[model samples]
Target: MEYKNNGHIRVFLVGHAISPNRGSEPGNTWNWAWELSKYTNVDVFAYPQHRKEIEKFILEHPRNNLRFHWVTLDNFDPWHPEKGESGLRFHYILWLRKVYKIIKNLIDNMQEPIVVHQVSWSTVSTPPPILQGVPIVWGPVSGGQVAPASFRDFFGNAWPKEMVRSWRVSFYPLILGWGRRVSSLPLILAVNRETEALLRKAGAKRVEFFLDCGVPSGFGLPKPQEVARPPGPLRLLWAGRLDFIKALPLVLMALRRVRVPVELLVAGDGPLKLQWQSAVQRLGLSDKVRFLGRIPWDKMKEVFQEAHAFVFTSLRDGFGCVVLEAMSFGLPVITLDHQGVGTFLPADAAIKVPVRTPEETFQAISEGIERLALDEDLRLRMSREAWRFAQEERWDRRAERMLALYEEVLSHAHRRV
Candidate 1:
C-alpha cells in the first residue's frame, strides 16, 4: 500500500529504550520510528546505551529522514539502570524529565507541524511527558492485565509479587491521579481491551484500540515448495522468558494429559528454568519436552520454521511478540483466550482455550493439542489462515494507521483554535 506525506508533519518519538538489536519494547520503538520515517521526518529520544547499536544500524542502512537524540541521566550508568523495581521507576521518571526538556526546546523553534508520541515502556503507570500546546499521543500502552489469582500456584514463590502487582494496577491510577494527567491529551492508544477500559475509567477523553506489535514485510509468505509434514510426534514450540507469569507448568501438565504423541521445544531461559526442568521430570515429560535455552533473535526464525505449532502460555501480557513471530512462520497457535492473545488472534488461526480453574484449562489445552496432532488437514488449513492474518499486521500498515491518527489529532487541534 502506498502512503503519502500529506501534511509534511514531523514526529518526535519519546521512548526510553530504542534499539535495532533488541526485540521487545525497544525494538518496537525502533520499528515505529523507522517505518514512520518513510512518510515523514522522525526524531527519536532514547537512552544513550543503545546509541552504539542504533548508529551502526543506520550506518549500514541509511535513512535521511530519521534522527536519534541520546538522552541520559547525570551520574547514573544509562547502560544499567538500577536493577530493582523502585530504582527502575525512579530512573525512568528522571529520564522522561530530561527527554521532555529537550523535546520542548526543539518544538519551540520548529516551523513545521509536529506531534509527540510516547512509544516505549508502554505502561500507564508511568506518567507521560506533560508538554502543553503540541498534540501528544500517549500509547499503545498497557499495564492493566492481571494474572488470574486462581493460577497463583503456577507462579511459585513469585505469587506474592503477582498479588502486589495486581493491587498496584487496581489502585495506582486513582492514587497517582492519571485521569487528570491524561485528560488533556488529544489521543491515547490502548493495546488491549483491559487497558482501554482502564484508560476510560481514568477519564481519558479519546482512547483507541491498537495492537502493540506488528510483523515485518514479507515475514509470513509461503516458501517455494511446501514440505510435507514429517512423520514424528507433533512438535509444539514454546518460546518466552521462563518467568512465573509465562506459566510453562500449565503446558507441561497439559502435555502429560495429551493422549496423542507430542514434543514441546522451549526456547527461552529465566529465573524459573531450574524449577521448571524439575517439574518436567516430575511430570514424566523428559521424553516429551526439550529446553533449547535462549535462542538468539536472528536464529529464532529457524526454530519457528522447524516447529509444527506454537504454544503461548503467558498469563499476563500486552501482546506476546512471539505469537506474531510464530504466525509469521505459518505456525498455528494454541494459547489461552485472554488479554491481547484472546482479543486479537483470530479463532480460525488458533485454538484458544479459555482461562479457568487450573485443571479445566489444562484439560482444554490437552484436548486442543490432541486434536491438532491427529488432524493434518486441520493443521494445514489453520497454518494458511495464520499466515494470511499475519500479512495484514505488517509494520508498514501499522505506520500508515499511525499517520492517519496524527492527521486526525492535527485536525482536531486546529478545530479547537
Candidate 2:
C-alpha cells in the first residue's frame, strides 16, 4: 500500500516496550509502527535490545520513512533478571526523561510541526512526560482492566499476590493530576470500554475507543472449510503466555468435567507451566493435553489450522490478539465474557462465559466446549463470523484510523498556536 504524505506530518512515536523484530512473534506494536510508517514520517523510539533485530528487518522489509531510534540505558529493561519489575518501574521515569530530551531537541530543530503519539503499553491512567506546547495523543492505553475479585484464588500460587498487585490499578485516579500538565490532549484512545470509561472518569478531555492490535500481514493462511469433529474426540487449541492471569488450570479442570473426549494443544510457556502441567496430572488429563511450549508465531498458524476450536481462558486481557488470530484461522473462540476479548467478539463467533467461581467457571467452559464439539453447524457458523471480523480489522485499516486521528490532532494544535 502506497501512502502519499500530502501534509508531511512528522510523528514522534514513543513505544518503550515495542520490539517488532525481537522474536518470531513481532507483537502488535511492531505491525502498527510498520504500517503507520507507510502513511507518515515516523521516528520510533524503541528498546535497544531490539536494535539489531530491527536493523535487519529494515534491510529485508524496507520502510524508508520509518526510522528506529533505540532507547537504551545501562541496567534498564523492565524485565531485567537482576533488577526485576520494581527496578524497571523506578527507571521508567528516567527513561521518560531521556525521551523528553530527544523530543525537545527535535521540536526545536525541525521545521515541520511534530506530534507525539504513544503507540504501545496502552494505558489511560499513567501520564507520560509532558512536552511543553506539544499536542499529545495517548493510548489505546488499556491497563485498567482487571479480573474479578472472586477470581483471586484461581491464579494458583500467585493468587493473592497477583490480586494484591491488581489493586494498584485503583491508584490511576490519583495520578490523573499529572495529565493536567499536558499542553493539549487531542485524543486518548482506549482499547476497551473499561479503559475508555476509566480515562473519562480520570478527567481526560477527549477519549476515543480503538483497538491496539490488528492482524499482521501473512497470518491466517488457512481458508474456511468444513471441519468435522470426529466421533472419537474434539480437537481444541489454547495459546498464549502460561501465566496466572491465563486461568489455565480452570481449563484443565473443565476438561475433566467434559464427558466428550477432547484433545487440547497448549502453546506458549511461562513460570506457571510446571504448575499447570502438574494440575493436568492431578486431573488425569495428561493423556488429553499436549504442551507445545513456546512455539514460533508461524507454527501457531499451523496449530490453528489443525484445531477444531480455540479456548481463551484469560481472566483479563488488553484486547487478546490471539483471539483475533484464532478467528482469522477460522477457529471459533471460547473466552471469558469479562474482558476486552468479549467486548469486540463478533456476533455468534465466540462462546462468552461469565467469570465465576473456580468450580462454576470450569463447569461453564467445559459445557461450552461440549456444545461446540457436538454442534458442527454452530462451529462452522462461528468460524465464518470470526474470519469475517479478522478480515475487516487488518493493520492497514487500523493505521488509516490512526493517520486520521493524528491529522485531527495536528490540525487542532495548529489552530491553537
Candidate 3:
C-alpha cells in the first residue's frame, strides 16, 4: 500500500502505442501509465501516432507525475503495409533502440533509482529491452495461444495462414535465440496459460501469470442489489473484430439448434463482415441475428446493458477484454473453454463449452444458450458472480500488483549488486 517512500519511484514505461481514444493494446498502454502514476512517477515512451490524443487528454485532466515522450524512426512508418511484417518487426527494434538511449542518458544523470516496464505490444516474440543495471519488468505478454486443429474447417481459406502461425509460435523462440534472452529477465509476466507454459519451457526462471486486460476502477461500481431481466426474448451479445480467428460462425450455427426465441447482436467490423453477413443468410439466421457494425467504445456500454448474456467465440486471444467489459455490466458469459477465457474466467460466472468436434461444440453452445435463456435464476446468479469478478480486476488493483512486482524486482537487483 505504501508505494511512495521518501519520494515516488520513477518508472520508464516503453510501449509502441498509448492513447485514450483507442482500445486493446493502445488503450492498455495508456491505462498502465495513467493508473501507475497514482503510485509512482511514470515517464511513458510511445509511438508518435498517438501524440495528439495523449496531449489533449493530459490537458483536460493533468497529472503531474505522468509524462509522455514520443519515440519513432525518421522516414519510416512501422505500420505501413508495403514494409511487410518483417519490416514492421525491424522498425520496432529500431524504435526501441532509440528509447534505450534516452532512458540510459536519463539514468546516468539521475540520483534516484528507475524501473523500466514494457507494458504494451504485449507479445513474447518481440525482443526484450537491453537495459543493464536498471530493473526490467516484461509483460503480462501473450501471443502463445493458437487455433485448435480440430476446428481448422472453421477458418476456411485462412487455415493455411493459421497453420504457419502455429508453427512459428512453437519454434520461433528457439530459432531466434529468445531462450537466452528470456532466461535472463528478472521478471516475466504471462497473460494466459499457453504463454506461461511456453515461457517456462523456454528456460525463463521467474514467470508469473497475469491478465493483460482490466476494467476501469469506477466500472460497474455500486453493484445493483438485484439482477433485472429486460422484458423481451433472450438477447445474446457477441462482440469482436469480424476476423477468421473470432469464429463467429460457431455461434451462428449453434443458434439454429437453440429451441428458444433469442436475438443475437453482433458488434464489430473487420475483413469478414460481408462474408459473415452472407453466412447469416445462408444459415437462415437473418431473422434472429443483427450485425451492428463497429460500435463506438463509449457507446458499447449501452449495447452491453441491453443484452442478457455475452458470448465469446474467439478461437484464440491473449484475453478477451470485451468479456470483462460485458461482465462489468452484469451479463453472464457463454464462451469456449480454451485460451484466456478457459484459463481466467471464473466457472461460476460463465458457461464454458469445451473445444471438441465441430458438431459437438455447436450443440453444447446451443444448449448453454438455451439453458441460460430459460432459467432466470441461473442467469441472475451468474450475473452477480460476473459483476463481482469484474470488480476485482479493476485497473487500480492491477496497478497495485505491478507496483509490488517492481519493488520485488528492484530488491532482487540490489541484492545481486
Cα RMSD to the true fold for all candidates: 2.2, 3.2, 2.4
Off by over 4 Å in 1: 74-86, 217-228
Is candidate 1 or 2 superior in TM-score?
A: 1
Model 3, 7-50: lDDT tens per residue?
44789999887788788878888889998998778999998777
Reference-based lDDT, each prediction: 0.86, 0.77, 0.86
Q: RMSD in Å for candidate 2, one decimal?
A: 3.2
Give lDDT tens digits, candidate 2, residues 283-376.
8998999999998876777888888889999887888888888888888888888658867886588888877677777889999999988888
Off by over 4 Å in 3: 1-8, 74-87
What TM-score would you give candidate 3 relative to the actual structure?
A: 0.93
Q: Estimate each model's TM-score.
A: 0.94, 0.88, 0.93
Question: Which window of 10 residues has the lowest lDDT sum in candidate 3?
Answer: 1-10
Off by over 4 Å in 2: 1-7, 17-20, 23-26, 73-86, 111-113, 179-184, 226-231, 415-417
Better of 2 and 3 by lDDT: 3
- Could you tell me which residue pairs clash in candidate 1? none
lDDT of 1: 0.86
Q: How close to the true structure is residue 75 of candidate 1, measured as C-alpha lDDT?
A: 85
**Candidate 3, residue 187: CA error in Å?**
1.2
